[model samples]
Every structure is written in structure tokens, then in C-alpha cells.
Target chain A: MLKKGGFVLSAGLVVLLMVALIYQIKNKYYLDILFMTFFWASLAAAWNISGGYAGQFSLGHAAYVGIGAYSTALLYINFHVSPWIGMVVGGLFSALLALFIGVITVKVRGPFYTLITIAVAELLYISAIQLKELTHGSEGVSLPFKPGWVNMTFRERETYVVLALLFVALIYFITKTMERRRIGYYLIAIRENEDAARALGVPVKEMKLLATVLSAFLTAVGGAIYAMYIMFIEPDSVLSFAFSIQPALMSIIGGLGTSLGPLIGSFVLSPLDMFLRESFSHINGLNLLIYGFLLVLFVLFWPEGLWPNAVRVYRKWRSGGVETKS
Target chain B: MLLQLTVSGILLGGIYALIAVGLTLIFGVMRIVNFTHGDLVMLGMYLTYLLYKGFGLDPYISLFIVPLALFLIGVLIQKLVVQRVVGRPHEVQIFATVGLSMMLSNAVLAYFKGDYRSVQTTYSTDTIQIGPVFLGVPQIVAFGISAVITLVLFLFLKFTYTGKAIRATTQNRISATLMGIDVRRVYTMTFAIGSALAGIAAVLLMPLYPTYPSIGEAYLLIAFVVVVLGGLGSIPGALVGALIIGVVETVSAYYLGSGWKQAAYFVIFILVLIMRPQGLFGQRGAEQL
Candidate 1:
């Protein structure tokens, strides 16, 4: 769905991001931000498959993340398994859970679906907290400092940044492949009008389930990466409602239903979030308070999001400053 | 013990019914999910607390003022924020209120600094003993007031012209408009009424639970469950759902443990949604609401 100029611009931006990463290889703060940007991009892109394209708009994605993080951590801590393998196992587990949820929820529409998603996530969160023998409860699980490729743990921040970038690329590739295939259009049709899509002979339920499964799998993998980078997994940190909202927030702000939008959103907002959290640490809730206003303002005025708006501006600028509505 | 648990559960359900009814009424009329609902209840609690502290007004007496103030605030919120996104995309609509919820709860967090506060009244700890079952005085009083308010609301909706207008708008907005009903006015009025109901719930609950900025977060999910279980937009359904949930909660707490009480209701919520999507008292096509 990207245009020629947009493609070139994105390519240029990617190269620039790589160069910056290399230049700031030694700077821990910069590396942290870059790692998080890629991490969020991966999540937003994965979420967009179901939330944006399939129109699932799930607010429970963090459950998958928590699943992946906890699964990876528990397996490594208890069984001495590699996180790379554990993440796949976690992803499969998350996909199974998604299939169950999707089968039940695919028929429900609008806010009801949203409400269920929230409830399911909260259920999992509570379970995580209560299953103290397995999860350590709210005290959280800490991974050992075993810096190895197979472990998916690294001593250097730059290594984690590269891994996070690979995650972004992988999810981005899957998103693009979905967009190019018939399933993408079918999902969009299902999103726009499920009844009509069903009338048109599209497998509405199956497609939704597919989207949910895939979205859950990728989100779980992203969560595993997050666990590796942070080396800590806590219900409050990993399974909080904020975690569920953040990926959707990035996707919405960057622009929904677009491959590039989520990346742009993560790249822009993740740094801003870190910066605000750092500067306003003493103010408690200041960042979230601002985020609340931002969500309202954006939804009301800029509902189409920044990516589409930026493209419009770029096209306008390229057209020799013409004021044409097109 | 079981009887005591059941009595306490029923009393707790009274407060829950008010909150759920307010939420369902708003959804029925406006087709908008008011995510800020829990926060509004929280706001009511804070308002009552402040009134009690500043003016030494009993929470019982502040009840007269809090609901009215909440009604005005609800009207303002509807006109300013909820009005613009009445028929917007689901994401837009959901996020709009979710955003509002965040702002409100966090604003309270920032202002009050996360302190847990509750009103101390003469009846806060007082209880009535009847044949080996003990009932907190505040709980019984709250339940009584809640029942009275629900009855008044029911009468008003059944008999008053404005209430009829609200119901008509809910049943069929296009036809209601065609019939010379001001749908917008009905929406604003319904929203205000919903908030006022939540305010009533807040006042009743102050003696029962501690007040905190995030206190609403605890109740919001339960309200949603009650609304869904009673069938969205069905006031009577909300009442029944709240009672069922309250009983389920208290019984599960007694049996499984307190931490598992929320789990029991949440599981019931998921089962109901998956199995009967329309709820026990809901019409088959209540999904349209």
C-alpha cells in the first residue's frame, strides 16, 4: 500500500536509524531508547494485524506479552531452557488461548468485544499474581545474566537493539505479506462489514480467528524479547493494563492500518515517553495524565492518525505548494 | 454464616445496581460506552469526602448535594466530550472515554497524591443484629437509599414525559426524532442521570469502602460485568445482574478465598458473554444497542 516516494523515504529512514544506532552504540541511554523504539514497533505492527486490519481492536494484547515473558522466564529459570525456544512455545500457547477467545468473541461486536478482551487480560493478570509458586507472584522473576545468543540475553545494549530491530523487521515483513495476500483484503472487508463479508462468501469467523492467533503469537514473541532485554518479568510491569494500551496507543498515534505508521509512532513516542518519565519522575502520574489528554485530542481531531496526515503533507509539499484538496 | 454472607452480598449489590443502571442507561440511549463512569463515581466519593472534611457535613447529608453536582458535571461532560463522538468509529468512541477515564483518575492521583481516604460517621461501624446475623448500619442504610432511588427512577421513567422521551430515544433514535423527540437532549439528559446515579452509588459506598483515586478501577469492571450480565441497556437487568454478581462474589470469597472472588465473577462474565451474549433479560437483538 506504500507509494514509491514513501518507500524511498522509509528506506532512507531505516538506514539513518541503523547509522544512529551504530553511532550511539556506547551510550546506554540512547541504546535503551532505541531498543524500546524497535520493541514497541514490533508490538504495534503485530497488534495492527488484528486490531487495525481485522478490526479486532483488542485491549488484552498484554496478556500475550505477559504469557511470553513469563513463559520464557519460568522455563529458563526452572528448566534451563533457551529463551529463543521458550518464546516460540509461549507464542504457540498464546495462539491457542487466542483461538479460544476468538471463537467465543468473533460473534460479538463493538464495545462488548472490547470489554471481554479487557476482562480476559485482567483474569490472566490476577492468575499471574495468584500463582505465586510458579510465577513468584508480584515479586517478579529475574533472569540470570547468561549472555548468550541461544539464551537471547546479551551483556551489551547494542546487541539487544539489533535483536529488537530484527523483531521489528520480522513483524513488518509478516504484516507486508498479509497486506499483499487476499487474506489481508478479506480481513479488511470483515472489519468493515462482517455481515456483508460473510454474505460475500468470506470465512469471517476463520479469518478473525486467524488474525487473532497470528497477532497473539507475534505479540508473545515481542514480550519474550522484552523480558530478555529487561531481564525481569513482573505482573505489574508486564501484565498491567498500560501494557495492553501502549501498543494500541502507538498504532493509533502513528496511524492505524498502515505498515509504516506503527513504526513511525513507536520511533517518535517511545523516546518522548522515556524522556517524560525521566524528567517527571517525581511528579507521579504526570506522563499518564498527559497521555490521557493526548489520546482524547488525537481521537477527536486526528482520528486518521499521523502517518496519513504526514503523507498528505508530504504530497502537498511535493506538489509545488499547491492548495488543491487532493 | 451463609445467611450473613448473603445479606451482605445483597446490600453490596444495591450500590452496584445503581452504578450498573446508570451505565446501561447511558449505553441504551447514547450508544456510547462511558468508560469514565467509574471515575465519575470516584469523583463523587472525593466530592463527598471534601464536603465532609471542609464543612463537617455528614456523608448522609452530603448525599443531597453530591448527586446534583455530579448531574451538572455529567451534563457538561456530555455536551463537551461525549456529544462529539456519538456515532464515531468504535475505536474512537472507546478511546475517547478511555482517555477521559485516564485523565480523570490520574488527575485525582496527581491532586490527592494517592492517599486513601474514607468518611468517619457515627454509623460507620454501627450494626444491627437480627437472629444471629449482623448487618452493618451503613450497609443497610445504603441499601435502603439505593432501593428508594431505583424505585423513584423506575417511576419517573415509566410515568414522566421526559423519561418516556429518553426510553423512546433508546428504542429507536431515528423514529424518536421523527416523532419530534429531541434525541440530543435525551442523550444529554440520560448521560446526566447516569452520572447522578453513579453519584448516589458513590455516596452510599463511602462508608463501606476506602476512597482512593484508583478505587473506581476496582468497581468499573464489576459494573461492566453487571451491565452485560443484566443485558446492556436493561435497567432491571442491571439490578438482577448486580445481585447475582454480589452473591457470587461473597460466596466465592467465603469458599475459595478473597483474591479469587473477582475471579469467580470474571469467569461468570466470560461464560455469560460466550454462551448467552444477549444475557438473561436482554432481547435477542439487544446487540443493536
Candidate 2:
């Protein structure tokens, strides 16, 4: 659906980003930021499929992230499975969980559905803590730095950045394809009005479940990748409400339901997050304070999100300029 | 032992009822889930802490002031932020409230640095003997006060002109507006009343529980469970739901363990939401959800 000019602009920006990535390969800090950008972009894209496109607006997505991270770390630690395989296992596990929740909440809507999602995530979080013997509990699990391709651990930070970028690209491509497909239409229809969608032969429950499962699977994969990159897995970091909020915030700021919006949001917000965290490390909660303000500001003034707003502004400027000349 | 657990549970449930009443009132009237409801309670706790620390004010005395203070804050919040999102989409309302919740909790965290604080009243550790169950004096007093406030709220909603207007608006916003009830004013008043109720809960909890920036986070979920279990907008539902949750919590904690108590109730919450979303006292067709 992108216009020619927009497509060219985005393609050119991608090329420039690649060049920057290559040039900053040696800079660990820059590489870290780059990895985060791509990582959040992927997570937000995963959320967008269900939350944005299908209107699930789940506030408990961190459960999938935690599941993925735990699965990969646990499998690799105990059974010596490759992270590649473990990641898939995690994705399946998260998908199952999502399917169960989605089925139960299929008829539920609005705040009630959102509340159930929160309760489900909290249930998992509590379980992770209680199942201390298996999941390591709140003390968290740390992976040995056995740098190897099979382990998905690399000596160079560049590899992780590339992996993250590739992951985000895969998510974007899948989202774009879905947006052009019949399932996307069905999801949007269901989102608009479940009854109307069902009347028009759209399997609303099945579509919502499909969206939930797909979103969960993709998010879990991102979580596994994050665990491998960070070499640590913890309930507090991965399973926290912040993790759930971050993806939604990114998607909302970037433009909900749009493929490119999440990418733009992550690229902007991730760097800002790092900057805020660094600058205000001593001042606890300052970063989150700012995030809260931004969330409020955006919802109040620019509910359409950054990408759509930018597009509108650009179009307005272009038309205004033409009119002045005329 | 079971009786003791049940008594404590009932007392705790009284406090939970106050919080849930506030939440349910806002939800029932505005059709908006005030996610920041817990944070308002947290703010109340801090206000109590400050009053106790600075002015040597008893928590009971601050109870009167704190709720009034929070009611004003609620008025400001409803007017400045919530007003714009009124009648908007559910997602918009959700984000606005969630965002405000984040801000309030974090601002408190930033200012307070996550230290847990509590009021050291004379009766903080005092307990009363009643039929083989020794209950904390604070718990009994808090329960008594909360029950009274909830009753007052019920009667007010039933009799007072503004309260009836609030009820009318909750039942049918369009009709209330058509009748010149100033639906927006009812919304502001309802939100403020909810905030005041949260303030009351916070004051009552201060003697028993420590105050922290994230203290509200735990109560936030419990409040949701209570509000949902009791039925979304029913005050009586909140009271009954809170008591059920409280009993379940204590009984499970005794049998299963402390960690699993929360899990037990959460499981119940999920089942109830799935099986009976309208809850026990809520009208079947009251909520579209």
C-alpha cells in the first residue's frame, strides 16, 4: 500500500541504516542501541498483529516473552539443546498458552478482555516464581558465555545486531504479507465489529485466536533471541508489566497496525530510552516518568501515532505549498 | 484456626471492598476502567505517611483529610485528562488511564525512592480478643470505618440528588443528558468519589501495611479481581466479591502457601470472567462485555 515516493524513501533510509550499522560495528554502545531498536521493533510488530490489527490490545504480552526466554534458557541449560531449536519450542509453548487464553476470552471484550490478559500474565509470573526449582525463580538464570554459532552466542556484538535486524525484517515481511491477505481483512473486520464480521462469514473467534497465537509465537521468538543476546533470563526483567507495556507503547507511538510504524517507533524510542536510562540512572523512575508522560501526551493529542501523524503533516505541508503557489 | 483465618479474611475483605467500590463506581458510571485507581490509593498512603510524620496526625484524622485531598486530585484528573477521552474508544480510555497510572506510580517512586513506610499508631500492634479469634485493633477499626463509608456511599447513591443523577447517568448516559442532568458533572463527581474511596482504603491500610511506591501494584490486581468478581459496577457486588476473595486468599494461604494464594484467586478470577462475566449481583445485560 506504500506509494512509490514513500517506498523509495524507506528503501533509501534502510540503505543508510545498513551503512551506519556497518560503520558502528566496533562501537559496543551503538551496537547495543541498534540491537534494542530492532528487538523492540520486532516485539512491537508482534503485538501489532493482535493488538493493533485485530484490536486485542493485550496488556499482558510479557507472559509470552517470559515463556520464550525461560524456555530457551531452560532447554539449553538442562538438555543441551541448540537455541535455534529451543526458540521454536518456546514459540510453540507460548502459542499454546495464547490459544488457551484466546479461546476463553473470545466472547469477552473491552476492559474485561484486557483484565483477563493481565490476570493470565500475573498467574504465569507467580508460577514462575513458585516453580523455583525448574525456572530458577526471581534470582534469575545466567548463561555461560560459550561463544559459538550453535549456541547463538557470538564473540562479536555485530552478529547479535544482524540477527536482531534479520528478526525484525522477517516480522515486517510477514506483517506486510498478512496486511495484503484475506486473513488481514478478516481480522480488521472482526476488530471493527465481531457480530458484523461473523454475519459476513468471517470466523471471528478463530481469527482472533489465530492472531493471538501468531502474536504470541512471534513475541516468544523475540524473547528467546533476547535471552541469547543478553545471556541472562529473569522473571523481573522479562516477565514484568514493563515488558508488556514497552511493546504496546512502541506500537502506539509508531502507529498501531501499520508495519513500518513499529520500526520507526522502536528506532526512536529505544535510543531515547537508553539516553534517559543513562542520564537519569541515579534518579530512579525518571525514565518511566517520562514514558508515562509521553503515553498520556500521545493518547491525548496524537492518537493516530507518530508515523500517521508525520504523513498527515507532510501531506498538509505539500498541499499548502501548492495552494500558496496557485 | 479456620475461624481465625476467616475473621482476618473478612476484615481484609472490608478494606478490599472500599478499593473495589471506588473502582466499580468509576467503571459503572463512566464505562471507563480507571487503571490509575490503585495509584490514587498509593498517593493516599503517602499523604497519610506525610501527615503522620510531619504533623503527628493520627491516621484516623488523616482519613478525613486524605480522601478530600484525593477527591480534589481526582477532580483535576477527570477534568484535565479524562474529560477528553470520555465517549472515545475503549482503547483510548485504557491507554490514557494506564499512562496516568504509570506517571503517578513512577513520580512517587522517583520522589520516594521505593522505601516502604508505615504509620506507627498506638494501636498498630494492638489486637482485640473476640471469641477465640484475636484480631488486630487496626484491622477491626479499618473494617468498621470502611463498612460505614461503603454504607454511606450506598445510601448517598440511593437518596441524594447528585448520587441519583450519577446513578441515572450510569444507567443511561444519553437519557441522563436529555433530562438535563449534566452527565459530565456526574462523571467528574463519580470519579472524585471513587478517588475519595481509594483514599479511605489507603488510610485504613496504612496502620496494617507498609507504604511503598509499588505497593499499589499488588492491590491493583486484587482490586480488579474484586471488582470483576463482584460485578463491574455494582457496589454491593464489590463488597461481596471482596469478602469472597479475602476469605479465599486467607484460606488458601493457610493450606497452599503464601505464594500460591494470589494464584488461587487469579484462577478463580479467570474462571468467573469466562463463566459468568456479569458476576453475581450485576444485571445480565448491564455490561456489553
Candidate 3:
């Protein structure tokens, strides 16, 4: 119980720090970066529920993002529906899509499921490009700003940052709740051994489907918010392989299956990504190379992720300098 | 037209079979999918291009040099990197290869600047007159070379002592170790041969398709689809699976719009995966997560 309290206290401190930094950073550019980081953190947390916690290892999460972005964008463009309503619709649609994909792929485990997810995302990407009439193809779509609460837009970056922080907090709470529940135990069980879980009378398929649907729904909400933030959406930008890779990278690099993993990962890696992109834009593909190299390095040297290492250190410090197992 | 589509599809299928066979070989022998298989092919193409452009060598002749080079690279990478994580978690293996792939591709991009480079062979423009269709000589040569290589590989696997050891390792690693076969040597050899085959395929197909750093992505996707459809650890199944995909892609591209060609193949791929998880010619008990 004290451990749990400590965890909550640390989380609260981090949130307070984020709020302080938002006000401290006067530059709009830095605020933009913070907002983007929080946004990605929220999505990465969503990805962690299915990928990190449930061990699904989905490689096509961009499909959900694209579906949410496009669905919301289309409704807003054609019917003039407020983004608030469209966001829910988009999330529901993505959830349904996830349900469909999960039903088909839940029987197969491991890399097979990962590959199918990639294929599904690729198919959606291609369709988005080919179906020019609806999607505008490669040209993409831009959202009209209503400059009000209904549109979820404000003139200042601070507002966006606050909203993103709220979203991240909500997602973190949900994940924490799930982690303490029976579903979390079942997910971890299935992750470790599917056959064993099934033999033990776990509803493996249903649990997996539920996890996937939740993942997709939350990811879609993130996408909806992203669309509102960017005020633009495109197939290539929204559904690219890189977008899919980011969540996985964040979850893995932070600490898979842990509540704080995705958040920590995004907090660290998003800044690196932004820095690399800005610095290496002239170097063609160097950014991706660096990203991949970092992933490899993390896998080799720190597979449990940065958060685990931090936790270990924290435990050691709290125990009055007791030597810990490596 | 249908006949023409069928013939073209068959020819393209032969190339797909050759590409996928290497992937299957690596997976079959070591249970490791060399995700960089396509990048090795890209390296092969670049090597061939340089040999032809600088040394005035024919692509056929450069094939010898490229495969040998890629074999060395494969051997070195396997010994240095892959060996370190032989029995580690799947994520480690995946990241290692994915890292190698990214590094190689980006290095190529930095060097080659994303230019579409192709070998300009004298016979590149030549074509054979088929019934209501034209078959390019380069493609015909690629198909013939693929067939010959496949046959040689099959023969080698069937007859040689080392080949039998590889097959043994593929079937049961512990049993092969028990039988006194060195599994490490088999892994190194498997990676080398697989990479060498990719090199050969690259040289064979260079005249027909443009080469670039990003070109590997196209082949990687196709190889992955074929490997899965072929069943991960089955060489013959890879060939048959490749043929199916190749034929499907060809016919679809010919009949439908080019944009929808990939979609059609992907649809078929998904359908096959759902309907028949075990690919054609794959053993019943070989399916793994």
C-alpha cells in the first residue's frame, strides 16, 4: 500500500512538473514540442494496453489512427458535425475494426499476428491513396478551425498542452485501473503463455478482443485530438509505417507491460525524434537509421526499458543503499 | 490475353520463388527470418551496378562477385551479431535484424542518394516474340537463372552431407546437436547461403527492375508475404507460395488497375492466412506462432 502511494505521489509530481514547465517555457515552439510529446505519450499509452500489456505486438496501429482521423475529418467536412461527436464515432468505428481484425487473428499468435496487422495497415494506406474521391488521395484534407470549445481548438499552445496533459492523465488512470484488475492478470497470463492461459479456463479470445478494441478506441481518440491540433490530415502522414513504429518503440523503450513505460518512452524518445528530424532533415534517411540503431541498442542492452532501470535505482535508494540484483 | 497473363505470371512467379526460397532457407535452417534478406538483395544490386559501371563486367559475371561478397557479410553478421542472441527472446532477434536492415538501407541512401540505378545490358532491350505477348530477354534470363539456382539448391540439399545437416537442424535442433552436427556452423552457413541467393537474385533481376535503397522495402514486403504464405520453415512451400502470389499479382495488375494490384494480392494473402494458416506443401505440425 505504501508502494502504491509512492507511485501516486511520483506521478503527481511529474504532472505538476509538466504543468510548471508549460508556463515556464515562454517560446511557442517549445510549447508545441511539449504538446506533441504529451499527444504521442497518450497514444503510446493506448498502444501499451494491447501491445505491451496484452503482448499482441501490433505493427499496424496507424490504421486505427488513420481511421479515426479520416472518419472524424470526413464527418466534419461533409456534415459539419462537431469534432466532439465525430471523435466518439471515430473511436467506435476503430473499435469495431479492431474487433474484426482481432477475431480473425486472435487464433494465430506471435509474428503472424504482427504481419497481418502490417498488411491491414498497408491495405488501408493504399486504399486511402487510391480512393481519391473521398480521401483526396495524396493531397490530404485540412480541418476548418471554428475557434471555440465545440471544435476543441484555442488560439494558444498552452491550451493545447493542457488538454493533451489531461488526456494523458486520463489514459494513465485507465491503464493503472486495468493493471490492478482481473483483466490485467489475464492479459499478462496470455502474454506469457497462451496455451497455458487457455488450459486454465481463461477466455483468451474474448480478452484479447477486448484489449484490442480498447486499444483501438483510445488510439482513435488520440488521432481525433491530433487532427484537431494539426487541423490537417493525410493518408501518408497519418497512416505511415513510422507512425505505427513510434508507439511500439515508445512502449518497448519505456518498459513494456508497465503502466509508466509508454509515458516514459514518449517523454524521452519524442524529443530525440524531434531533434533528429530537425537536425538531420538535410541528411536524407539518417533519422530513421538513428532511430533503428537506438531500437537495436535498447533491445540489446536494456530490453526491460529505461523505466525499469529507474525503478531499480529508486528501490535501491529507498532501501537505504542496499545492493540490488543485476 | 488470359494466356499471356498466365505466362507472364508464371515467369514472374519463378523470380518470386527464387527470392522467397532464400528467406525460407534461413528460416527453415535456423528458425530466424533474416528481415534484412531484401537489403542484402539491394546490396547485391548496388555491387553489380558498380562492377558493371566501373569494371565493364557483365551482370552475369558480377553475380559471382556479388554473392561471394554478400556471403562474407552474412557470415560476419551471423557470427558477430546473430550468434550473440541465438536463443534470446524473439524481440531481440527482431530488433537485431531490423537494426541491420535500417543501417544498411540508410548507408545506401546516404551513398546512392535514392537514385534509381539499373544495369544497361545489351540484351536489356531485346525481347522474345510470344503469342500475342512480348517477353523481355532480361526477364527471361532472370527466370531461367532462378530455375537453375533453385534446382541446384534443391540438389545440394538433397545430396550433400552439409546439406543434410542443415535439413536436420531445421527439423530438430536438439536432435541434430545430439547427432553431433554443429548447429552454429549450420546457422552461419544457412545465413551465408541465404544472403548469397539474395545476391544472385538481385543480379538476375537488376536489368529488369530499378535499384535503390528503398527498393528493398518492396521486396521485403513480398518476401514476408510469401514466407508467411509458404509457411515459415518450408522451402518448397515458399516456392509454391511465391508462384501463387506472383501469378495473382501479375494477373491482377494486368486486368485491374496497377494501384489495386497490391490490394488484390494482400486480400488473397489475408484470405489464405485466415482460411489456410498452413500454406500449400507445408507440413501439418510445423505451424508456430
Candidate 4:
């Protein structure tokens, strides 16, 4: 984590980069790519809270995201409640719902736990589809696209990017703080060995639930922002298994449980996803095929993920360990 | 109507049982939940689709060929990918198969373009009427095939030396190794056997259902429910669990809307987890709390 002064410096540098990036974006597409990178970075960090820090491999985060997205979208479309308020309600609602699920499956661990998480996500997806009057029966809901600050919609794409960057930065600070505090230690202890941690009076259930709530709330907030940015929402589009899996995939690829991992992962992967979308538009499944191959390769060989592994290699090379060893 | 649903559920249950048995076998022996087990099932279905499409090979005939081929694939997967994640954390193991699942399904999507495909056969629409109930011919055939294969598998595990070795290894990996059993080979073999069972299931299911890449996601959920409902590692348990799920699915779909069918089983799955994580047939000590 950046120290207090380093944090300020990094913040300033990020602001500078933001200005340069905004100035450099000549068209909507590049702006979109930048918007998506920060957008994905925020979501991945939200996932890292529960999956990475708390050590619960939740493959069903789309449930919370969908809940959040739908809560804000539906309220805005139907009731005309400002999404700013809707986002908070949605985030809090998702947290409560996650708590209910946690009550049911908190004692469960391992693959069984993963299965339950998936089941819950699928349950919500089905619910979203079935509740046609509310969710529109897969027809999806869309905002009015009213260009106003209250609606969270903006005339300028740069505003979205700036908002996304702020989201990422906010979640990053929370993660960094939690990682150094008692909550983070308790979570890691529970993750490393729940039984041992419980024996040591770590309050495993409460800690796990707390981490899950925070994670789910942040993810929902991102979902709300995403809905505003995209101005459209659907069950399959938002709550699909792929949406659920992507966060897990990103955290794993970047370095599961690390503060910088998700940021680094999204910074690397979002561009690749965009590039694939650009170049492989004609191809059917090439993008996912490549992602799968890359994921499997990483799981087998580079389980430490990308960023840390790169850091290790760089440090070794700089210290001349390679030459000495050779 | 009740009889019809019961009959159909059991028939469909046979297919579910076949898939779940393979999944439970892998989980039982290796303690690695093969999330890709359903993908293997999907792959098997595609293989059948391709064979029937290209060579005019009957799916029934392909059943013999498919399982053998799938066995080889399963063995390779266990050796190359699954083995590496065996002793690792749950996250690694889950993601490893999750990645494989993504890879296999997406590869199919890329190549097949997500069009739902089905084989045309004389018996595809044929059904037999018996005492106010109708049974689809292909469904009967699938049920028959699943039962025969399951019986054969049960006998193999009961009597055959290799099958017994697999069972012993499942019971205690280190002890089985200490007793000079080739534990590694046994794991590989179990995985192969499991995959073969999934292949047989896919072949049986092809006549009744259409093939698509993401179809695995549907069956994978069923397999999970069945694996947990039936005790992990117990073949009979998987069979029993599959039948229960099949009946529950058809009944709920009949009474409730079709969209809510999955939610019904998911409720049962969660209930089972909370009330009895050991499952209906699972021994008390089988699962770690």
C-alpha cells in the first residue's frame, strides 16, 4: 500500500494521467476502452474483498451485481427515484440479501460452498426472468438517457471515466485499509484455516459475513454506475454466469487477495478483451477460447498470478540474481 | 398425469444419474469437484452430434465408441490439469475446472456458433403407450442404457481388481498406496471411468434433448445437486439422488412455471446442505464439517 505521502503522490499522478487520458481520447471508442478498464478494475476489487481476502471463492457475484443494477434501474424507470439514492438502497439491499444467504451456507466450505453460491446466483437470475412485470421478462430495462447529473447520465464520456476512476480509487483505499486492520487479519486467518481461527476466537462467521457484505455493497454500487453508463439492463446481460465468473477469473489472474491484483488484472485484461472484440469480431468463440486457454495455463503454471510474478522476476533481474545463479 | 410425471422423471433421472455418478466418482476418489464434468457431457453430446451428422452413425452405436474416447480424454485431463490442483487450495481447484469448463464450452460456441442441434431418428418422436401413460422410445432406450451401464459399473467395482483398487484408493489414498496399490493410476482410471459414464449419459440424452455449448451449465447444476443429495463417492447414492431431483424437477415444472424448475431444486439443494450436508445416503463422517 502507498504510505500517506505516497498515497497523495499516487493520487496526484493518477489525476495527471486522468487529464492526459481524457485529453488524448479523440473518439468514443478509446474513451470507452478507458471507461471499461476502470469499470472492470472497480468490480474486480469488489470481488477481491470476499473471494480474495475472506477466502470464500464466490462464483456467484452476479447475484449481488444484478440486485444492485436492477434496484437502481427499476426504481429510476418506474418510480423515478434518483439513482444516487437507489444505488445506496440497492447496495444495502444486496448486503442484507447476502447476509441471508450467508446464514444458510456460512458453515459450508470448499466446492460445496462454491456450488451453493452458483445456485443462489442462478436462483436470482431465474427470479429476475420470472418477475416479468418487474424485470420485463428478459426484454430488459433501460433508463431515459436524460443527460443530467441527478440521473448519473452525462453528455461527456469523460465524466463516466472520471466516475469509474473514482470508484476504483475508493474501493482500493477500503481494501488497503482493511488489509492492514483487524478485519483484514481476521479474514486472512479465517481463510487460511477457519477451524484454527475459530479456536483462536476470530469470530469466523461474523468476519466472513462482514467481508461479504462490504464486497457485495461495493459490487452493487459498480452495477448501478454500469447501468447508468450503459443505460440498459437485462437478466442474462447482467446476471449471467460469465459475469459472475469474470471477477473470480480476474482476481485469480492478478494475484488473489492482493490490493493491487484486481487493478493490475483489469488494466491488463480489459484492453485484451477490447482488442479481441475489435480484431476477432468476425470469429465466433475465439475470445472465450483464448481466455479459457489462458486461464487454464495460469492455473497450472502461474498460480501466483501475473503482477506478483512479474515483480519477482523484475526484482531478481535488477539484483543480478540471474547472472550470479547462471 | 402423476404416473406420467413419475415415469418421465425416472427416465430423465437415469440420464442425470449417469452424469452425477461420474461427477461423484471424481469427487469421491480425488476430492476434486470436476466442474467440467458436465462440459465433458456436452462434449460427448457434440461428438455424438458430429458422428451422426457426418457418418450416419446411430447415437446408440456411438455410445460404445464415445465412452471409450471420452475415457481417454478424462485420463488426459486428470493427468495434465486436474492432478496439479489436487492438493492445492479450494480456490485453485475450483478455478482450474472452472477454466476448463469455460474453455470447453467457449471452444464449442466458437466452432458451433450456438445453434441448437439435434439428431433425426425414426424413434426420436416414437413413444409407447401403457395404461394411460406414454413413454418416449428414446427415453426408454436412455433409461435402459443407463441402468445396464450402471449395473455393469456396480459389478465392476464390486468384483474387478482394478475397480476394487479404485474403491480402496477412494477410501484412503495413503493406505492404498502403502498397500502397493497404484493410487495415481487409480485416480486417473476413476476419472476416466467417470468421464466415460458422462459420455454414455450424453449419448443417451441426445435423442431427447437438443445440443448446445452452454447446455453443460444446466446439467452441471443438476450434477451438483445430485452429488450432494446422494452421498459423495457412493454410486447408488448418486442414482437415488438423481431420481429424487428428476421427480422434483418435473413435478415443480408441471405445477409451477418451467422457469422456476431450477429454483425448486436449488431450494432443495440448500436445504440439504443446511439440514444434512452428509446427504441422504452419505455416511456421517464422509464430509468434513
Q: Which interface RMSD values do the candidates have, in the order shown?
A: 1.2, 1.1, 1.7, 1.5
- DockQ scores of all models, one per candidate: 0.74, 0.77, 0.60, 0.73
Instruction: List the pairs of residues colliding in candidate 2.
Output: none
Cα displacement (angstroms), candidate 4, residue B62, comes to: 1.0
Give the Å shift of residue B197 in candidate 1.
0.6
lDDT of 3 by residue, B60-178 (tens): 89877998998999898888777776777666676677777787898888777888998888898898887688888877888888999999999999999999999999888999999
lDDT of 1: 0.89
Question: lDDT value for candidate 3?
Answer: 0.84
lDDT of 2: 0.89
Against the correct fold, how does model 1 do in TM-score? 0.96
- Choose the strongest candidate by DockQ: 2
Tens-place lDDT digits, model 2, residues B158-190:
999999999999889899999999888999999
In model 2, how large is the Cα lDDT of residue B149? 92
TM-score of each: 0.96, 0.96, 0.95, 0.97
- Candidate 1 lDDT, tens digit per residue, A215-278? 9999999999999989988998899888788888888888888888889888878898899889
Report the TM-score of the second chain of model 1 against its true counterpart: 0.98
Model 2 agreement with the true structure over A49-124: per-residue lDDT tens digits = 9998898989999999999999999999999999999999999999999999998886678777788888889899
